[model samples]
Target: MDERVEAVLRDGRAPGFHGLVVMRGGEVVLERYGAGPDHRLGEPLGHVTFGRDTLHDLRSVSKSVVALLYGIALGDGLVPEPGAGLTAQFPEYRDLAEDPGKAHLTIEHALTMTLGLDWNEDAPYTSPANSEIAMELAPDRYRYVLERPVAEEAGKRWRYCGGATALLGGIIARGTGRPVEEYAAEALFGPLGITDFAWTKGGDGVASAAAGLRLRPVDLAAVGQLVLDGGRGIVP
Candidate 1:
C-alpha cells in the first residue's frame, strides 16, 4: 500500500487528483494529500496545495449527499414519500403538470433517476447545451426540468439526470421551508461534526444539488462511515 501511494505521488498519472482517505471500523487507516488544480463550479483556481483541511468539490457525489438529505427529511415527515406525485409537489407549474403523461410522474422516479425527461449531459459541462447547465441557466430550474419534452414514460428505464437530484433538493427546500444548505447544516453536516464546507449556488442563488458540494477529505469519509453505519447519525 505504501508503494502504491508512492507511485501516485511520484507519477503524474491521476491528474487533478487532490486527496485520498481510507477508513476501517470507523478509524482512518490511510490519508494523503497533494497539490493539484482546482475549480469552483468551473472557475479555475490554478494549482492549489492540498491538505486534510482543504475542502474539495465532490461533483456528482453531491447527488448522493442530496439523496441522504432526502432520506433524513423524509424520516422527519418533512418531505413527500416516494409514491408522492412529482409534479404535484410543484403546483406553481400548473401548465407543465397538466401536460400529457406528466401527472404519472412520482417522486420515486426522480429518486431513481428514471424521470424519462429529455435530458442530455453528453456535452461538456462548460457548454450551455448540456442539460444540467441549461437548467441552471433557466429562469426557474424546477420549471425547466418539469417542462421538458417527455422522451420515455417515467420509471420505464434508467437515465442519468442531474435534474432529478435538483428536484429532490427543491422538494427538501420547499418542504422544510428553508434553504437546502441550511437544512443540511442542521440535519447532516452539524450532526456529523463537519464545519468547513461550501455549497455552490447557481446564478439564481439556488444551491446546485447536481454538483455543488465541497468537503474536506476526512469529512467526506465521515459521510461514508455514516452510510456504512446504517445512517445512525443524521440519515435516520
Candidate 2:
C-alpha cells in the first residue's frame, strides 16, 4: 500500500469507508478493505468485514449501467434513436401524449435527465415527497412516471430524476423482448465476466433500472475499466 493511503486508513478519517481499489494501465495498483458495519440510511445492520467479493449495492450507479446497456442495444439496432419520441415504445400511454410538452419528450431527454417532469427528489430520500418513493408506491410505476405533469420543456433543463431510468428500462425491454436484467446478463455482464451480481425489480415487477444493482467492488472496477476501454472488448 502507498504510504499516504496507509496513513489515511490508519487515521480512520473516512467514516464507513469499506473498500478501495485503484487500477491503472489495466492493472490493480492499490486494493484495501476496512472494518465497518454495513449501514442503510445511517443505521447499522451488522458488523461486516469488507473484502473484494462482498457485494455492495450500486445505488444510482446502476444508472450508468443502464445507459451502457442502452448504448449496446443501439449498436445492435434494437433500440430507437435518441431523438425518438418517448411514447413511440408505449402506445398504451398515449393519453400522456395529449399534453403538448410531454408529446415532445424524447429518449434523449430521459437519458440526460432533462425530461422536465414534475419530480421532487430534492428532499431527503426518507421524506414522503421524494419522487422515487412515490413511484414505488404507485400501482403502475410506469404510468406514474409518464403521467407526471410537465414542469418544463423537455431538454430545456436537467433535473435529477430516477423515473426517467425506469421508463428507459421499459423501453429496452420492449425493444429487445427481454427483461433488462436478462438482457444485461447476456449483453453486458457475460462479456465482462461479471457472473455474480443482482439486478432487482421494483414493486411493479419491472427491473429497477434506476438503481437496485448489487455488485462486488472488483466487478464494479471491471465496469470502470470497460468504460475506459471505449467499448472495445465488451461491445462490438
Candidate 3:
C-alpha cells in the first residue's frame, strides 16, 4: 500500500489528494485512503474531512464523464455518428471552414483530438494571443472556439484537445435542445443521485467540459458499485 499518504499528510502536504476504491461484482476487493490537506486550498480555509457529500474539482475527470455522456447519447439515438460535421449542429461554422480541407473534419476527429487546432492550453490567460484567452475575450466563446484556424490536416494525428470536449458539450446541448447542466441532470446525474456539483459557465453560457465537475468520494465509489451491477442501479 502506498501509505506514503500518511507521511505526506503528517508533513501537512496531503491536501486535495484523494483515495481509491475498487469493486468487482459488487464486492470491494481493494480500499485505500490517503491523508491529504483539506480539499479547499485557498484563503477562507476549509476543514479536512472525508466520507461527506461534497463536490471537489475532478480536474480532468469531467472529461471522462463527458465521454460517457457522449456514448450514452450515441446509444440513445441522439447523435448519429462521429462523422457528423462541425457545422451539422452549429451551422454558423459553415462559413469558417472556408478551406475545403477543413470541411473534411468530423466530430470523431474532434472526439479523438485530431482536429489539429493550435491552442496553447498552458498559455497565460493574460496573453491576448492565446487561443483560449482570445476566446474568453470574444463576445461569443462558442464562435471563438469554432473559428479557430485549423493547424493541421484533420485526422492526420492525435492531439490533446480539451476544447474538443467543451465543444462536444455544446453539441450535446444542441442535440438534446437544452443546456449542458440540464441535459446532464436529466440524463446522467439525476438518476445516479449525484445531486451536488458545480459547472463554470462560459461566455456562450455553457459548462466547462474540461474541469467543471466535482464529485463525492463515496458517491464515486457508489458509481463503481453501480457499474459492477452492470447497467442496474442507475435509476430507481
Q: How do the candidates rank by lDDT, highest first?
A: 1, 2, 3
lDDT of 3 by residue, 1-236 (tens): 34654566557675555555655656655654543454321212255444455455565677767776776677677765788876566677667655575677678876887887776677654576656556655786666766677787888888766677877887877777787777777777777777876766655666777666667765666665665566463322
Best by lDDT: 1
Higher-ranked by TM-score: 1 or 3: 1
Cα displacement (angstroms), candidate 1, residue 39, comes to 0.9
Q: Model 3's lDDT to the true fold?
A: 0.66
Q: What is the TM-score of each candidate against the true structure?
A: 0.96, 0.92, 0.76
Model 2, residue 153: distance off in Å is 1.1
Least accurate 10 contiguous residues by lDDT in model 2: 36-45
Candidate with better TM-score, 1 vs 2: 1
- TM-score between candidate 1 and the true structure: 0.96
What Cα-based lDDT does every candidate model obtain?
A: 0.92, 0.84, 0.66
| RMSD score of candidate 2 (Å) | 2.0
